[model samples]
Target: MNPIDRISRRINTLIQLPENKEVIFITDLRKEYRQDLKNFIFGETLAVKDGKIVIGKNLYKRWLQKIKTKGFDYDVKFI
Candidate 1:
């Protein structure tokens, strides 16, 4: 399969959380792929709920800060 299809397949495998439910948590923004988060169309805040996933502005900001500090250095498993 093509690379895009491969990535799509991998992403599809992760769409459902361990609970076997569609992931609605903002923490699900973490990705296994090392590609820039800004380029990811579906996993970012902007894509979730068409930008309605707002818990709080500070909450989102803190989330971003945590991600940056933790760094996207390892593959993320949805479990």
Candidate 2:
């Protein structure tokens, strides 16, 4: 498995978030992890519709690169 897969798997396991979920409510997250999730989503063009954050198709790829280059250091599982 690749690093990207490892990171993505960690995200899925932690959040159970799907790309087609439409929106991810900020309220659904623990306050401490909100910033980390925000940072991760900031990698791509972010959209908020009806008070939910949108997940773009390229988010995982961008986040993967960020992780590989040490751009994103937050441990999703720990956050």
Question: 1-79 in candidate 2: lDDT tens per residue?
Answer: 7788875665564345444454555555555456665777765677776777655545644544565577445645532
The pairs that clash in candidate 2 are none
Q: Which ranges in model 1 have alpha carbons more than 4 Å from their true place?
A: 1-54, 72-79
Q: TM-scores of all models?
A: 0.27, 0.40
Say what the RMSD of model 1 is.
11.3
lDDT of 2 at 55: 53
lDDT by residue (1-79, candidate 1, tens digit) is: 6777876566554333333533344455444442433332235344346553423344444444555577444455543
**Listing every candidate in turn, what is its Cα RMSD in Å to the true structure after a full C-alpha superposition?**
11.3, 6.4
Best by TM-score: 2
Reference-based TM-score, model 2:
0.40
